[model samples]
Target: MVDVGDDAPTFSAPMTTPSGDIEEFSLADATDDGPVVLAFFPGAFTSVCASEMTTFRDRLDDLTDAGASLYGVSVDSPFALEEFATQNNLNFPLVSDIAKEVIDAYDVSMDFDALGVEGVAKRAVFVVDADGTVTYEWVSDDPGIEPDYEDVEAAVGDA
Candidate 1:
């Protein structure tokens, strides 16, 4: 998995924008503007995923104040992501890693064999600075777990 101080692996993928439009998103381009918070979730509309995403939505201003942009990454299709964003009233974009390339690049891919779900991203968060270096990383094998919001905000400030 990617760790702090490591160069972040940049990727481009389809995403559902805040304006409910489907578009391509490039991690490198996002970092070029400022720090970026990539929140990788197992799936959309799940209980823990919903809570985690809504928490991020509520705290978006804090990250933005620190000059950071946030994006929630998932293996869901962009169409599903658009509906998910609308349902959650999320103000940030939701990246669709349907091809699982981003998850693989970050080494955070996982599977739920019993549930027949595979190639989904494990719950993870990475704070990438403008220079493309990961300033902070948080990953969890437990899908129910969520990252520390305060710590992520602090990392953005430091970045």
Candidate 2:
């Protein structure tokens, strides 16, 4: 897994835009603007995932105020992500890692044998500074778990 102080692995992938359009999102481009928060969830529309996303939506202003941009990453397609964003009223972008490359690169990939789900992202959060260094990292094996929003905000503020 990517650790704090390590250079963040940059990636470009399909993402849901604020206008509900599918577009390419580049980590390099986003970090060029400011620090970034990458929150990886297992799947969209699931109870825990929805709650986590809504929480981030409600607290987005705090991160932006700290000069940070937030993105919710998942293995879902851009189309599904767009719908999920619209349903949740999410203001931030939702990145599509349908290829599972991002999850593998971050070492957060997991399998749910019982559910027949494979190569899905484990719940994880990585705070990357403008310089592309990971400033903070939190990962959970339990899909029901959520990151500490305040801690993420603090990390972004520090970044």
Per-residue lDDT tens digits of candidate 1, residues 1-159?
789999999899998999999999999899989999999999999999999999999999999999999999999999999999999999999999999999999999999999997899999999999999999999999998999999999999999
For residue 132, model 1's alpha carbon misses the true position, in angstroms, by: 0.2
How do the residues 1-159 of candidate 2 rate in per-residue lDDT, one tens digit apiece?
799999999999999987898899999999999999999999999999999999999999999999999999999999999999999999999999999999999999999999898999999999999999999999999999999999999999999
Cα lDDT of candidate 1 equals 0.96
Cα RMSD for candidate 2?
0.5
Q: Name the regions of candidate 1 deviating beyond 4 angstroms.
A: none
Q: List the residue pairs that clash in candidate 2.
A: none
